[model samples]
Target chain A: MRYLLTIVADGMPEPEKLAVLQRECPRWVHEMDGRGVRLLGRELDPPEATTTVRVRHGETLVTDGPFAETKEFMAGLDIIECANLDDAIEVAASHPVSWYTAIEVRPFAGDLHLGEAAAAFARGDACGEPFLLVTWMGGTPATPVHDQAVADEGDGWRRDLDRRGLHVLGDALGRPDTATTVRVRDGSTLLADGPFVQGEDFIASIDVVRCQDRQEAVELAASHPVARHHAIEVRPFCNE
Target chain B: MTVKPDVRQAVDAAFRNEWGRVVATLIHRTGDWDLAEECAQEAFAEALRRWPSDGVPHRPGAWLTTVARNRAIDRLRRSERGLQLHEQIGREAMLDDITGGSTPVARAREIEDDRLRLLFTCCHPALSLECRVALTLRSVAGLSTAEIARAFLVPEATMAKRLTRSKAKITAAGIPFRVPPAHVLPERIDGVLAVLYLTFNEGYSATSGAELIRTRLCDEAIRLARALHELMADEPEVTGALALMLLHHSRRHARVGPDGELVTLEEQDRDRWDCAEIEEGQGLVEEALHESRVGPYQLQAAIAACHAGAAAIHDTDWAEIAGLYALLEDQCPSPVVRLNRAVAVAMGGDIDAGLAMVEALTSDPRLERYYLLEATRADLLRRSGALGRAQAAYARAIPLAPTDVERRFLERRLAEVRATGADESGPRPS
Candidate 1:
């Protein structure tokens, strides 16, 4: 199992404290990596530099800050490959940041990037490699005839993916009527009731697919049933 | 109420103590708050049906936990949406066993930490204050929405709505179920203390009831506070809040007389105070004060310590109490703090000065219907030889008193003033 450790802190620590933490963190990171536990780690920019974008209904909601209102922001993150939760906790607890800030440990669903999907997915393994986000966009609303075709098509695609042992995640989003848009400007949150951009077709579904390379990602995206009526955008994530 | 069997009683007790932990553990496992609560409730309901026949499990918490987790598994396997939740739990189970090699004992400890995480999440500062209080009482103290509504004197529907909104917000906003980091912990700690203190105060001084105290709520509040203190012992405010609660609770026995009349602190028998509680509270106060952060809770605890340290009313260090209240006012100034300070000043020595202070607050709208303002004014006026005005003030305050005990106490003062014919004397005799 791989675990993601989110290091949350209020603003940033003072220069001296940050310096001390920075000095100590690398040593522990090296220790974990040397022991074959650490997979990846990165320090995030300050919250002020963050831009949050949400698409609901049809409007694109963008904010200058993180989605959650909190004094403590995600200062950094680390992904560690461990045996289990107990192993994950042990690895997490050893982080020097845990002393000053909270270390949130959450297990990775699967090793999407490792391209071990065929074997692991057959075993129902949740932990794997890297994840590529496959978004199905701009599909026509289903009518009586279209509904059966869509369902039949979707089932066939699902079975094919399952047969190939491809573990994908995500659910289809509801129509624009059920959507809501939230945007923040100049520290004031402006909420528009209806879709800001109106169209018959919109983002219908999203899935995190395990793929080792661009070719594999594109192949998986092309295999989706929705690709016949909609565009599938395959974006590879830089980190877990 | 019919008498319950021993096994049933034990199950009931276990439910109160273990409900939060069970739910927290399930939430930690599945990351689904609604499902966790639902499964935990189902487990408790199952316990009720089976415990009578099974004669109660040796470890009721463990039994309920196992049953709850299994129930969650069954539900997830059967439901479409729960597929993801089920998968997460399955992965976690595998991880737990394969990685660090968790034993039963280690798992139990993890569950304990889950409760703390749940509490911190429930009391997160991001939630509204009312939402925080309702969530804390429901999630941490394991009180029903209706029960919390009754305790807080709100309608069941309002409380239910408040609780639902808060929970939805928590889920939608992705508030992690964990304690906040050090820098942010102080603000979050304050939010938690506020909820605990509100719980304690509701019990210490019932806002509206025939009785002045509700020991059950008080006990629950103290228990929750102690648990928080144990989990975060280094947090000075947690220690300070616990100390403050203990010092006030030590006087619980003497707070009311045999006739169920409110007993003024000065008139209550000092010997009746719980010495053990006072000693422990004083120790905590010293410990917290030494740390030098000096939060509002620590200041209030110091004032309580002043009263607890005194052997008698005269022995009480009114000046020190007044000084502490002043510092408290500086930190969080309010009409209530000034009112308390005035009383302490009057009890310390200068009745005339206290009366002037009380008079100054006459036009403050917030204190207009505040019974303490009227009661304090009446007391100070009676002591300063203004019987007519004192009797009128007492008359004005009696109707405002929330509890019958306070009303009776005020009526007695009115009778005392009428009988004495306006004598310039000290506080009315009990």
Candidate 2:
């Protein structure tokens, strides 16, 4: 359920290595944490400062260097608790070093005794709120349906949700170009921009609701008017 | 040095994801499934050594397969048995008869032929209908046995055995991986079209996924259908399958909400529908209908065309759809088809007739546990003012519904009936 992703950034010596870890790793870690995956990351001292000793025939053989003689050394590690290996792998694979240095993913071997810290990391438990995010292109409202038309046509949906004691959150009318664009340049600082790369249209709004998982959230969102025209992106919120 | 963990993970993901496509291309080029798979594996192994340092190539599959093929050739030169086969193949290569290219499109075409070959081989007359479907889904559609089992609501182990037996039959009967002769093309093409249609349907309305629609799967199925259409332009069913896929896909944008929730057809915004795809699909339907010889696919396409042509839910020609469903039943009489036909009949104002048809289908063993069937019957009953029966039907349907969304929807229907306190509904649920 939990994996420690150890990214070994070997060859690149000096401040460049530390800079990459400092700037890139935190952003990636924050994104994962935002998605409800508990993350704890730290940078380790260089391998040269580390010591490894082997005992054979009651004799100790001490080595001044690291265990593996690879260009990249174990620079840092991020501990992530996920629902399953697949989920963990998705997170690990998205790390900055996934495309460059070697990332070692090892499952947590045993249960942890975190004491009071565990409660602080527990995810939120809000669920069963029905909401529809209707996205409109060019900042336009959905087709003018008389209150009667919606009450008539969407009666089935309303009746269904009402029986379940679920109430739809009020709709958001998004700006013409509401998306915030971020670009990772030269594997460093992210460049922020306005409105997703100009296309035929832009994402108008996002419907947010409290649900159990992606599947439930998606199904509930599908009934919204905006989904009929624009793309829908689903992301679960961290309970905390 | 031990392989870097990140490199290992990337290689593994790439292997799992790209292995099939690479093997498919190699199998077509080499004309040997086992050898192509081996070559593809070898190529990936080489990538593990080089990619971390040099960075991944722009076209990884092409690079991997080329390296593997060259490695295979070098190995062949070193072996006595391989040398003889290599010489024969070399002669064919010298003759300039074999197609050679490294582009993805060219490789895809080769793989497409292999797909056609696999389709025919899987649907060989010796195989049972279930076996054919399982084999086609596994080999051609690239679905795992577990995925196929989930689709058919069967145990994974049983499905795996079924796949094994189907493969064994192919081997024993010497079913060559090639298209059947022209004389038998019509019937064989039907099997191929059915398999493709099923694949597309599964993708368009995934039985279980966080997303309502799996666009990748839909795209893949459409691409396959298009290839079949191109190969057999004279075949009416091929045209029909392509038309149906286009028409259905044209509604994909309107099928989900901005928050990724499911959307029922009646609530969909008509202006959002892709008009270009609709136009293209309409053209194909017209051509297919002109053939005079009606098939199940063409009939289904006709039905979809009716829905697509409508300006709004009220404007839908329910009578025409009901008529098309009647033809479809005559061509392929299944409980599911009849159930859908009942809805059309109800929409056409023949509520009594629709209710009767639905009631008849409830007794069908094939539909006893089918949630949609119960839901359909409940809708009819509720419309006819039979609240007690409708409530019971909805309750029965709740347990059978697979997804939370469907269950929630059904529960809502049940509540409405209860709230009305046995009053007959004004209009039937669509």
Highest-lDDT candidate: 1
Candidate 1 regions with alpha-carbon error over 4 angstroms: A1-240, B1-6, B46-59, B82-100, B103-108, B207-214, B363-365, B422-430
Which stretches in model 2 have alpha-carbon errors above 4 Å?
A1-240, B1-31, B40-72, B75-115, B122-173, B210-214, B256-262, B422-430
Predictions: Cα RMSD each: 12.0, 27.9
> lDDT (0-100) at residue B323 of candidate 1?
93
lDDT of 1 by residue, A126-204 (tens): 4544343323344342221253365356556655765665655433433333222333244332322222234554444
TM-score of 2: 0.51
lDDT (Cα, tens digit) per residue for candidate 2, span B166-260: 65444322345677767557767876776677767767775356232255457656876786787678888899999999999999889776655
Q: Supply the global lDDT for candidate 1.
A: 0.70
Q: Chain B TM-score for each model?
A: 0.86, 0.73
Displacement of the residue A62 alpha carbon in candidate 2, Å: 71
Candidate 1 lDDT, tens digit per residue, B1-430? 3335886788779977898888888887777777788888899888888887677888888888888888776776677773567576674573243224588788777878989999888886546667887888777777788787777778899999888777765654345688776755676788788988987888888534523225667877898899889888888889999999999999988988887788889899999999999999999999998888898999999999999999988899999999999999999989999989999898889888888889999899988889999999999998887888999999999999987878989999899998886453556765
The clash count for each model shown is 17, 16
Docking class of 1: incorrect
Scoring only chain A, what TM-score does candidate 2 earn? 0.42
Per-residue accuracy of model 2 over A96-194 as CA lDDT, tens digit each: 666455464444323322322223223222244322222324323234334333323334553454455343322222222211122223543221112
